[model samples]
Target: MLAGLSADYYTRLEQGRERNPSAQVLDALSRALELDADQEMHLYRLARLVPASRGGGGREPVSPMLLQLMDTYAATSAFVLNRTLDILAMNRLAEALFSSFADTDNLVRMVFTDPAGPEFFTEWHRAAQSTVASLRLAVGHDPHDARLTRLVEEISAASPAFRQLWEQGHVRGKTAEAKELLHPDVGRLSLTFQAFDVRDKPGQQLVIYQAQPGSPSDHALKLLESLSANYRDHEDADLP
Candidate 1:
């Protein structure tokens, strides 16, 4: 009775026999369950008592202004990701940073299935955990999203680790974090990344990584920038 509901009522709610739970009841349940902000929002979505805050699935066009803004970060690695962790757009340095991966389309896939994942992320376990948590938060936003369903299914089938983590029920959104990467070309890179939600485009996150000024990682980032530029130039030359 922490939710102030009788056992039978709670059982009916759990069994889906009782539909149309009022907002007050949901709020009580959320409080009783000690759910976090993300989890609470997910609860509302699952109940169909609230509308999704953003699009459920599919890729959206990145704003041209945002693309130009990302281009301005010459030395930094910057990219935009949707709720499903799909890399919708990225700058040259960001692409170069993930160059070793066979695919850089999805963050969860990159962390779990990519062969380079274990080596590229210096703290592989942390990366895996955070990726799963982030996906969990996404699921809360739109549980019926077909693309997200397929992604979760594909990864769960392929990775026992992902399965284990998925069962843990952790929910979190991407936030600022310090990440270490062992780039194939640049060696170890200690970088700080910040995740910002795009105000105009809900479910889109802009992530940027930077190394401390005058640090070894900073020098490495400069080298990577040059390499990225040269590689892009070569690709352009090959187009003829």
Candidate 2:
């Protein structure tokens, strides 16, 4: 009654018999579910506004405009990630801040498969749990996505931590939070992050990290910038 959706229709939706929902119906359902902004967005994606991952290369589709936006952030480290936690794009500083993205392309695998996982993520338990939860949210959007399925299988087989978390069945959407990391060059750093939604492109998030002004992490950022410059000058490699 709240959504003016008939009981039979709602039942059909729940029973997987109804696939299409009008925009107004979707709005009403969002209200009925009492979804917050992020949850509402995730729900729409789950309803297939945009698939979890599209056909093409494994990377998420990053538009030139988005790439330009990422380019604008010189001091701030920024990157784009897909629902599956694939680090699709990043500015030079982000590569430097996170150590190297050449090997850790996928965050899920990085936290589990990489030998330096514990060292890289200072908060290992929290990072591991959050990665699993975020993946759970992503899977809801595209249950049959082959790449995501294979990733789950691989992580399950490799990481006992991931396997235990996966068995617990938790779902959490990505949210902005202060993150602590042990950077190889700069020692320990504290950074705050924002996960922005690409509204026109669902299932894609633009993440930016910032350290507090005048803090040790802030100084470390400057050092990372220097390293980034040197790498660019010498290697001429593209940012990950």
Q: What's the residue-level lDDT of 19 in candidate 2?
A: 81
What overall lDDT goes with each candidate model? 0.90, 0.81
Q: Write model 2 residue lDDT over 23-117, tens digit each, in one string.
A: 67789998987777756666666677754554323465788898888888877999887878898888878878767334758889889988778
State TM-scores per candidate.
Answer: 0.87, 0.76
Which candidate's lDDT is highest?
1
Query: Tens-digit lDDT track for model 1 on 1-240?
Result: 899998999999989999788999999999999998877877787778877576543588889999999999998999999999999999989999999999999999999999999999999999999899888877767777888889999999999999999999788778889998999998999999999988878889999999999999999999999988998899999996
Residue 91 of model 1, lDDT score: 95
Q: What ranges in model 1 sit over 4 Å off?
A: 1-21, 32-34, 234-240
Error of 2 at 172 (Å): 1.4
Off by over 4 Å in 2: 1-58, 100-102, 236-240
